[model samples]
Target: MAAFTDSDGTCLFNLNDGKRELVNGAEAAQALVDKALAGRDHTAITRICLSNKSYDEGAAGAIAEALSKMTSVTEADISDVIAGRPEDMALRVLAAICGGLAGRSLSLIDVSDNAMGEKGVNACRAALEGQRETLSALRMCNDGLSASAMEAVRDLLVAGDVPTRLTQLHFFNNMSGDGGAKALAQILPHCPQLRDLRFSGTRAGRPGSVAVANALAACPAATSGRFVSLDLADNTFGTEGAAALATVLRKQANLTLLSLRDGSLEDEGMVAVANALRGAAPALRSLDLSANDCTGACAKAVARAVASCTKLEYLGLEENDGFGSAGAVKLAGVLGGLKQLQRLQLGQCSIGTRGAVALAKSLEGLDCLTSLELNGNAISEEGMYGFTEALGAAGKLSALGEMDDNNAEASEEEEEEESEEESGDEAEAEEETEEAAADASVDELTAALGGVKM
Candidate 1:
């Protein structure tokens, strides 16, 4: 039930005495469009998400129509849908409509996880180029389109009437290969206002990666645009590619967040990065190296490097191919050493009870951690218990997840260990026992002296 509610526990869409009934995507979209046109005194529903829902025919078109009609709509998010091939045609229509609308203000439109083929993507590019002022954030992630489609997207970006507020553009997990990325990187010099770019799971190879890195390296600080975010997850950027990119990062001081998660960053690549950002990029705050085949040594090096960059706050190492129990322990040990660490992501790292215990110990020493996302791991009941026990011992915590019986048992063990504070008394009792033995021996000697011994 991903529904929004008001202060009175009433659903936002369930207003107006139940006059607006929307059980499906089409219905909801139609209601929103109709309501906006009629001035029905309702909130703007242009920003919508159609996840885990059924849809009727031409649902995408209906959504696009509602979005196009709303002049005040700033975003439209409808991910994980299987709109038909005809959906692209509808999207084009919406794009045309968005271009023609005088008061159109739609800035974002997310249609990710929809296997809209190459054709659909072409339509998307056409529409976006046509309505550049109104559309900025476009998410076509997790779709199936060849490299050519991505190139088309790049070409469309080059088209005139481009908007400047286009900050985020996510096309990750799509099969847009190197050719597409090349096309995109070519436009980097032109897009002076682009801030965030996500290309994870795309075939952004050495050539494409080099193009992007070069573009970033050459981007001047005085330029109106800065690549604040760069996500290259699940790409095939080996050491050569990473080395080239690392060179760019070394010089690109304006980058605030850099994510190489799922990229083919190996030990060599890690070393390259370690050399690159040792002192450069002082303003960097977020770095994600997840799913990279980097071992504990690499992670330790990374942590050490980050420790020097005092402004860094969020570091993600989840789902790495080489981070094991040893790696987790090393990282946990260094956790408190970092003074500005606020958010840490270690999801799916195969952490066990020992790793959990180490992390708990680290948490006990820290006072700044705000949120920790530990999903999809082997953290059994014991791990959860250790975390809570540490929280209780530390006397304060931002937030912690649920704990099972095993966690409770671990906590009890910790409490028991804490209660044994009178070790001096036990030592004194042992000394007294030895003294009594000596006294008994002396009494026997006295008895023998009195001629009363057996």
Candidate 2:
């Protein structure tokens, strides 16, 4: 042990359990052979952070090589290494982790913020295809993985016919556009056990969004819904694409949480989506559809649909083109009927004193809202003051966590929801006096969830 430590080699300290434990494992440990290496604990010894300051290439190799000879470590955290700059050698170690089937028990592997190019992805693919028993979740977002790399991995997953065991995949802020989206579409049907999927900033426009949701909805995989939680925010899903997912959501009754923030959904698209949500899903809990082009007329249609989605918990409708006082008033009308809404967001939606007054009146009867956001719309100082006063009276924002949809109405009903607060009723008188409303684009609406920002 002393010789290896002195030689700057990786040392595995074994206890009564006969398992090797690395020392001072804080830095490169997770990256070295994260999936390959796991720990075994006993009362006689506890694993400590491996000292990474003096680490060398041999150290990484040693870790990977050692993985083949070890077994039985339940608590494996490899995110620290994935947080570092990519090194070919380190990725090799990563390859070895899966090569040795070490990820069998790995619950999480953080390979984010690294330049794990196509080669690295292939290596990880090899590991994932190994079908390690204990591997349950993976986060490969923000790793500078290009569209080609995603496509490459997707092809491998299909061609290899690997079984679906992984439940979580995070790919936030990655430029995995159309190619990546297509690749993922092919795999979504096979992965029957998926739980959390994040495709933020993947540039997955209309075709990809529509294709993926259609695949999921049409396949038996969706019916099983062993899968849950789908976050496709910032993917620029236009109105048409969003409506496609809306159809899927109708069949997926088990999904609990969904986020499609910052996707450019339009009013007509929202109308289609809202109409679908009224009776399709048997078990959807929360949804977000913020930042869309849903103006007053569109918001009214959506409000009408949400009035009947009894299981919805949260809703976000911010930063759209027509979500002004008129929109708020109509939304307020709908809020008057929702009995289960827990959260609501309406930020930067061209709200003014009249809108604020409209919202305040409709929300007065709200019993479940706990959080609220009115960040950047035309909600003047007076409007904000009134809005705040109403919230103080209501005592909640329901359960809203995020609000981002280019045309909040265009998202696939992932994170936004409906509620009948006092604001809904306050707008009734105004709504009765309203004039003709403009038509919204259905094509543009559904694609909003594809991350179409103005």
Candidate 3:
């Protein structure tokens, strides 16, 4: 009964409505294919996920053939399904889908964790050539893609016959280094619709990161005010790379989400980014400076950045041990005015009891704040108790509204009336019956529905 479904109710591998509880072997695969083929709305099969399914080559080939016949499938995830075999078998399984899905209007394709090495990528390149006009997203994370395979991917990105529609690309945990990054940089200006790009943990060093930053800066979409999100975490991009991206941030008005976690963006680089936010980046909402080496000196810059961003919502500063009590107090000073701020993560920042109390006092002013992560900090029982008391007092103030002490007796009488209603009197109660039980259940459901605010 496990499956994946979209908001539109289109699903893949959903056996919930099927007659059988469980299915197995090539026969079950064929049955699944038959059901798909017999369905009137083949286009409803927008996602074909065979992840973690135990099936043989015959079953895989049948499913691939069935998928090829579908009129339109936007997203397909075939990760970890071709297990217990050589990489070539996995490549063949992918080839079948690529052949069928060629020239189809498939937007997103994920083949991560399949161990499909260079040959598999080469085959996918051929298959993807037909989808040059339609494919907008491709995820090949942890698939053993090397620097050589990236050359083929680069060619596909810059194919001259048709304008590339790629908007999102992920190559996380790949073996590609500066060479692969340079290849990708050449096509960044070509993809005007590119919104989300991730190269985390891909061994893209300083050179690679700088190249990406340059390409992003030169990209027409970025310069023309199209919103874009870029994640370059764990790449060891040093101060020079961070400075280059800071320049990009100053120019790219639509650049919203930027994640440079686990990189070498220390105090200097952090200050550079914060300065960019303070000067430019008005539309910026989410900023993740986590796992960096930022110290307390960068706190004022970050606070200024938050103050500048009137619509800032999510700020992630996790694993930056340099931000101690002083930094927390500095940040708390400005958070009172950020009515739009909601999610804040400051885990492992060395914030002590005093800092926690400072933050808790600020939290009272932020009515929009909902999520706060403070794990791995130095907050003790007293600090936590202070936060609890402050938050509880704020909750009561919000709940009581305009009610004053003068209405205390009226409130008590109302509570008594509710208690009486909850514990109905035996003298006036009717005998319990099947109809009464059903009516009570209906009443309970109605009351529950009425209690819902939204």
Better of 1 and 2 by lDDT: 1
Clashing pairs in 1: 234-262, 385-407
Q: lDDT of all the models against the reference?
A: 0.58, 0.57, 0.67
lDDT of 3 at 362: 67
Q: Write the per-residue lDDT of candidate 1 for residues 1-454, one digit (tens) a residue.
A: 1222346421122212323222344566566445534543334543434443334444445755544544444554445444442474444533433342335455766656656656656544433555455566777787765677776666656665343456777777777677767766665655556678777777677767666656655544214335677777767677877776776666656778888877777877886886677656667888888887777557555654564455668888877635644556656645665557678777666554555555666666456767665555455555566555765676434545432222223343443342243133223323433443465478679878899655
Instruction: In model 3, state the lDDT of residue 109.
Output: 75
Backbone clash total, candidate 1: 2
| TM-score, structure 1 vs. true | 0.62
Candidate 3 yields a Cα-based lDDT of 0.67
Score candidate 2 by lDDT. 0.57
RMSD of 3: 16.8
Say which candidate scores most in lDDT: 3
Off by over 4 Å in 1: 1-32, 37-114, 130-136, 159-165, 203-211, 219-225, 251-256, 279-285, 309-313, 319-333, 337-360, 368-454
TM-score of each: 0.62, 0.69, 0.75
lDDT of 2 by residue, 182-229 (tens): 777777776667777777777777777767666767545566655477
Clashes of each: 2, 85, 0
